[model samples]
Target: MDSISIDEILGITRGELLQGERDLKIKNVKIDSRKIQNGDLYIPIIGEKNNGHEYIEQAFLNGGSVSLTQEKDRPFPEKMTVILVESTLEAMKALASFNRHRYQLPVIAITGSSGKTTTKDLVASVLAQKYTTLKTEGNFNNEYGIPQTLFNLGPEHEMAVIEMGMDHLGDISKSIRSVDPDIGVITNIGLCHIERLKTQENIFLAKKEILQTLKNDGMALVNGDDGFLKKLKEEKNSYQVQTFGINDQQSIKALEYVSNSSGLQMLVEWEGKKENYSFGFPGVHNVYNCLVAIWLGHFYKMTQPEIQKGLDAFVPSGNRMNIFSIGKIKVINDAYNANPDAMKASLDVLETVGADYGRRIAVLGDMLEMGDFGPAAHYEIGEYARKKADVLIGVGDLGKEICRGYGQNRNDVYHVANADAAGACLRKIIASEDIVLIKASRGMGLEKVLDYIEGGNK
Candidate 1:
């Protein structure tokens, strides 16, 4: 990390240091006092439960050389250097914004209702083929996360892939303005955070705020297969807009498909040329991610072979469509997070791959926070799951809706209260050659069932 010294941070400070050696230079700034290291500057942010300002003494003891805080009347630590600010959080954001302007790297910002993290990972991997790349780590795509990611950037990094997530109307714009991306990518808008935004159109509007802070020469890469994105044409003199998808008119497109339980194989269309590609990640949704990365690779002038190697190197981590075999049963563990669109996509994968296999089963949990649409959305999953799978097991309160949707016609439908119960029943019911899919929101911890079915205790 190319760190700036305490003198440099003081130069950006709103107020003066209270004590300690004037010439002492701290190498890094940390918000959490608990993680403070020697020669580190800690920002005391006021928050719920406890105030960070109250921990300045502990911070100094933990080797925090300097402190940034709003309280001026607090007892001064004997030799601790203090940099007073009007507000610690605002100052931290300001420092992050200032640091962002110091880098000449291409910052790629990705956002949507779903797949932001996966898509960010894919694009970063591809870009890494040509540059020294930095990417946002797991779930660090929010207000604090965005600034933490920016603060980690140094002179050596040539490019950055930032995943921006927002639930309310001004959130995306605020984060984008902070990062000021050179490339804005939208994976696809879907039903997420509807409790605040209300409708899909509102979600689209909130997501399109990525354009608000993009550089004039930046590009907006969108999913062309998305009906909403397909209808949007670029305005003259605005930032460049490009599309990637399997259908619709797009600068990048996917052609030739062969998807099985193992993974995906397809050809990508880019710049009037087409090339075959193979990916370890399964599902058509991931194919769209590949097309986006290939488009970005072409943008950075990577040769076809290098781009192909980069695509092949990408892999899904944790529980994002990670396929594994337990004895004779095949399990598709995609229980990281769930929504209507993602559930439908997973069902599509199961239907396409289960043609000649044994019984196909879908172990689904409630899709939470849909507001008035929660029950109906869960029902939709049951409706779709019944068509693609031989058995459907629904869990949680909303799982009742899923069970009701499947109705008496589907004799294999079973509803359970939690993952442990579902797992116990599933272990006895599944037979050899059975293909099962486990999916639900993060709170449901549906992976428990996946783990149990694969021999882990729930």
Candidate 2:
């Protein structure tokens, strides 16, 4: 990040410099004391279990030039600069906001229950064909992660694609307001956060917050296939609205698509032209993600060939639709995260891609944070998996519910207590050339099964 003077930071965050030269410039900002570098500003966050204020001395010892503290009377190293703020988190957000607005580049903010990361990557790839772009890394879409991403912005970046994820109301509002995106995209509304949100309507309302701080001339792109987002096309707003989906009625629609174990190819109708596009990822759900990227590329006046090059260059993040072979068997490791919607989509991929293989094996774990909807969601996913997988291994307590839904009478269905047990069962039943799908929520740690398979078991 570009260096900023202590005076500017104090002015932007309304922080008072407890000790330091106002003219000193900080070249970088960090939250973790272990990551502190020379001339870096350390902002200690107060989390539930750990207090960052306690790490101030360590940060300074590690070459931190400045630190933000909530404790006003706290003692620090003799020469270390300290700033007192009401809250370091808020101060970081303020500083991030200041850093973001320094550039007049277009910011594309994406938020949804699922596919936000993939959409961000695709959009950034397409934009990169014509401009130097920056995109969020991994699942860093939270309040803290958003600011950290914005801190990396420099004069060399021509655009940014930010992903926003939320569990409570106002989460997206805070992030969106900080970035003030030129274009907002909602991938879809689903039951991923139903525990905190309560209902689909409430989730939609929460996701819609991304548009609250959108520029007046901005454009909102949504998945027209989603019943909730489809209504957005009718809403009157300060910005223009565009719909993209496989449906015939969308503003940008995929006319026909085909997916196999190899990859996906589709015919899309955009801007009064129908063209064939192919990307090396196999999932029907990804069609929506590609459509969003395609629309954004065309909006920026990128040539069709440039857009296709971006599409061809795109790569799925690890553990999300990451296809590979373990010996003779094919493994679709979509264990990054899951909900009912995502689980069903992955099951579809398992079914379609595993068609030529020996057997379709689905080793699924719990879908956590469903609240009252947990049991039914797991059971329904089991029922959905019946036709997709020849053998089903369910992990965790809720995973047992899946086996029950898959039917106890069938010997092909097995319920295990954890990933290890699931791995053991998989080793016994999994044959050479069999296709397997491993999926669960982030909390489930279902990726262990993949590790177990690769760890000399295969």
Point to the candidate with the largest lDDT. Answer: 2
TM-score of each: 0.93, 0.98
lDDT of each: 0.82, 0.90
The TM-score between candidate 1 and the true structure equals 0.93
| Candidate 1 backbone collisions, by pair | none
For candidate 2, report its TM-score.
0.98
Worst 10 residues of 2 by lDDT: 449-458
Error of 1 at 92 (Å): 1.6
Writing each residue's lDDT as its tens digit, candidate 2 over 124-201 gives 999999999989998779998999899989989999999999998888887777888988999999998899889999
Model 1 lDDT tens row, 62-180: 99878887888998688888877787877777777778878888889999878887888888888888888989987788877788788888888998998998878888776776789
| RMSD (Cα, Å) of model 1 | 2.2
lDDT score at residue 347, model 1, on the 0-100 scale = 82
Off by over 4 Å in 2: 456-458
Each prediction's RMSD to truth: 2.2, 1.3
